[model samples]
Target: MTKILVVEDESAIRSFIAVNLRRQGYDPVEAASGEEALAVMEQQQDIAVAILDVMLPGMDGFAVCRALRERFPAMGMVMLTAKGQEQDKVQGLQLGADDYVVKPFSPKELLARIESLLRRLERPTVELGSRQEASFTSGPFIMRPDQRKFYKDSREIELTPREFAIIKLFMENPKVALSRDDVLNSVWGKNYIGDLKTVDVNIRRIRQKIEDKPEDPKYIQSIWGYGYRWLGGD
Candidate 1:
């Protein structure tokens, strides 16, 4: 899945963008401040895009954007702010922001840019060498990369295309907590604006089947402030 980091201070606007993006089928991660955004990065290494609000309280968007560019120079970034200042836009672009938009911009337009950025991030698929190719497994959950099939113990698990994609990501990175944005990009395409609740809903369905007890959940664990992890047992 493609991962997105949203750095915005305003609760209303932050949620506004998040909900819309989620409904469109993209995983959306939220950071109320730049500090939190950094912490999120520490846990996840496969971020594809960042949506930054320029007038942040503590660290400001420019510093964060510049810092991110220094490390992940190829990562996509989109800056947002109430300020219409041309200098700020120029600075953000110089710092490696792919797109900059003033506040009050349409949610539709923002979603469009996000999709374009993700499209640019993807590289053509390559065939893995036979020796290096590996199947992802946890308990009865088994993923066959060659066949793209998921099995519970030896029984096949029924899944929609999206569900199959989500399972593939978790099985591939067991133990690592994946944020919602990461799930979305990995399972759904980037720029997919959809309901995030869909992730939670699907997880519930997944738990019901693989776990001995869904309420007392095992295998796929929720990481609270983070996202989900496939921890191998129930």
Candidate 2:
């Protein structure tokens, strides 16, 4: 059973989420604040996912999500915010959150989002029977599917789970022009509901990490008004 970290200052909402999580057979570890959530995570290293409230007491959910991504790149993150504004959702995703739920969200919707995140996290294997190789190589990039490891110019690049998925999708389908919708459907899951610009934000982040010059990216190129395509040489 994967343990879930629930971080919310409001006692009633915290308990409500924990109870629902329990009903769904998830073991939820609760925390009343961002600081306490970090402490809890330190004691419990097995936490697979963290449900973070944007309106945290001190650190705030954006900061927490950023911190947690650095500390545990593999762990999944979902942001909970009362605001349904597109900017809030975009900011959370930019900070490495896997998903976001507006406050007063249906329990079923929340659980479904959680399950989607978990499923993506568990994708530890990518079979390539036809091309027997230790890793997939394109230009200066090398990806070890089994290890979820990525390297550029022979230097390893640390990636959040979301970033990893986005990069892998591009690497696997090099030269194919993929629209924002295509990227979102492939990386964020088909059920994801958000602005198409979310894909652009993620792509920009990935470019910064992997490209020699993000301003003039060599591998990822925008196709005028259509979308983006990978130019990495195989």
Candidate 3:
């Protein structure tokens, strides 16, 4: 069964979410703090998604999100932040969270958001038998869809699942300027409701990984008012 890790310092909220998750036919793993969340992940191998609160006892949600993202690139992460705090939502996304639910959200709203994220997670990057091989090469970069990894100049570059998705999308449509909305819909799912700034954050993160100088990127080029385009070399 698919398990979801709910990490919240407040027992009341944690229990509420767990109960709802159970009702939704999903297994819930509860944790009172970030440390416990990490421990739970280590012990439970079936955790597919994590719902983390922005405020925690020990490590904050942003820190925990970054840590979990590094360890589990494919795991879906959703942060719970105070309503109306746009900065918190942006921070969570910058730390590689897949989605965020503001505080005071209804159970129905939260479940809907989780369902959207899960749909994205379950979506295959590339359908089998549609391609000759699960790989692509452009310029100095080489990607293997089967491995979900990136390589530049034959050197491995670590990328989160979202990062990998964005890179793949750009690579497949090189020289085309993709709008932020296009990227959000394609990568985060059409039902995703969040700041479009997330595209900027992930793009910056990708440049830091694949570019020699992130300040002056050569591959993913910004189009000012539009969005970005992949500049693949010969």
How far does residue 213 in candidate 3 sit from its true spot (Å)? 0.6
In candidate 3, the residue pairs with backbone N, CA or C atoms under 3 Å apart (3 or more residues apart, or in different chains) clash, namely: none
Off by over 4 Å in 1: 124-234
Q: Write candidate 3's Cα lDDT for 1-234 as tens digits.
A: 779999999999999999999999999999999998898888886789999999998799999999998888889898999989989988888788877888898899889888877765664455567753467899999998766668999998877667878898998898999999999989888877676888898898788878889999889999999899999665
All candidates: TM-score: 0.52, 0.92, 0.91
Model 2 weakest lDDT span, ten residues long: 126-135
After superposition on all C-alphas, the RMSD of every candidate to the true structure, in Å, is: 16.6, 2.1, 2.1
Task: Report the Cα lDDT for residue 78, model 1.
Answer: 86
Off by over 4 Å in 3: 123-133
Q: Best by TM-score, which number?
A: 2
- Tens digit per residue, CA lDDT, model 1, 10-55: 9999999988888888788899988888878778758778899999
The TM-score that candidate 2 achieves is 0.92
Candidate 2 Cα outliers beyond 4 Å, as residue runs = 126-134
Q: Local distance difference test, per candidate?
A: 0.73, 0.86, 0.86
Ranking by TM-score: 2, 3, 1
